[model samples]
Target: MSYTPLLQQLIEALRCLPGVGPKSAQRMTFHLLERDPEGALRLAKALTEAVERVGRCDSCRTLSEAPLCPLCASQRRDRRLLCVVETPADVLAVEQSGAYAGLYFVLGGHLSPLDGIGPEEIGVDALLARAREGVEEVILATNPTVEGEATAHYIGELLREQGVGVSRIAHGVPLGGELEYVDGSTLTRALAGRKPI
Candidate 1:
């Protein structure tokens, strides 16, 4: 029997999520329909609200509901030390380690010319502007991937031009591994053992 048009549409919509295939989408649609309708409603509502309410932090470019992210807004954080990462997930991973007490600047993404993503596309200018604002140290916590390395290098150059101290996170992070997937201890070590860029 064919699924209803609305159900099919839901499945298709779910497939747009990263790593979610047709089978996973179909299974999720069925599970949401049968086992957890209220949960699914809450999920839908939260997704809508997050998409509408959450936006990039004006200064550091991290995702925020307000003009600045919680980290940027908090006076308790070390404003002098800044950790630069590729995404909000990276920020969360570093935060989970409880190692970094400084503020963060999320690039939103890495440099990828072939993918049509450039410095302007990833808000590198905003990050450079932030770096110019008397920050003592800027940690390049981008992933160990090619694009991530390129982004780190690009930012390092910009910060060096501004006479700002720049450092790259230590190689404790597995080669080609994403920060979000690395263990907390490893992340902590990477942060603590950071070296000059």
Candidate 2:
């Protein structure tokens, strides 16, 4: 064996994190054991606490310790604008942009029929129920992947049927991205979504 059983187990556990391959996990394990054992203890403590205490917000379905997340409970946010996204991380991204001052509805994931994930799995009924509670516009902020697109389209149609306005967050070349470096699909999306000043 390359490592002691406990050491190998630590490396394997570390690999569970996104983008952390075997070599990276091994390095992290070594760093934790040799460089900063105290930090490792803190990380373990925090992860355990979060797993025990954190849960989905009753209102938006985003991860939260309380029944309603801070964003859903905020009185200052615009109630008429509801931004629907695929995950908790997406909610953080939109909040970090500071361009949106409205409430959010986190879908937890997009529809993927092959994986047995569908409208019910992602809480479409809950979203529709939320929309009917006074939201005027639902901005679909789902990722631009095939599954994300399908999920958004499905939800958009349902929202429209209920008389709620639906819009999609534009997807294309990123800010400061060069045209030559951009892919054809992204370029096409950019062109299609362009607005005249």
Q: Highest TM-score: which candidate?
A: 2
Q: Which runs in model 2 stand beyond 4 Å of their true positions? A: none
Candidate 1, 23-94: lDDT as tens digits: 999999999999999999999999999999999888788778999888888989988898999989999999
- Residue 46 displacement (Å), model 2: 0.6
Angstrom error of the Cα, residue 149, model 1: value is 1.5
Task: Please list the residue runs of candidate 1 whose C-alpha ends up more than 4 Å from where it truly belongs after superposition.
Answer: 173-197
| Model 2: residue 2 alpha-carbon error in angstroms | 3.8
Residue-level error in angstroms, candidate 1, position 14:
1.9
lDDT of 2 by residue, 1-197 (tens): 67999999999999889999999999999999999999999999999999999999999999999999999888999999999998999999999999999999999888988889888999999999999999999999999988889888999999999999999988878988788999998999989988899
Looking at model 1, report the run of 10 residues with the lowest lDDT sum. Answer: 169-178
Best by lDDT: 2
Error of 1 at 169 (Å): 0.6
lDDT (C-alpha) at residue 169 in model 1: 79
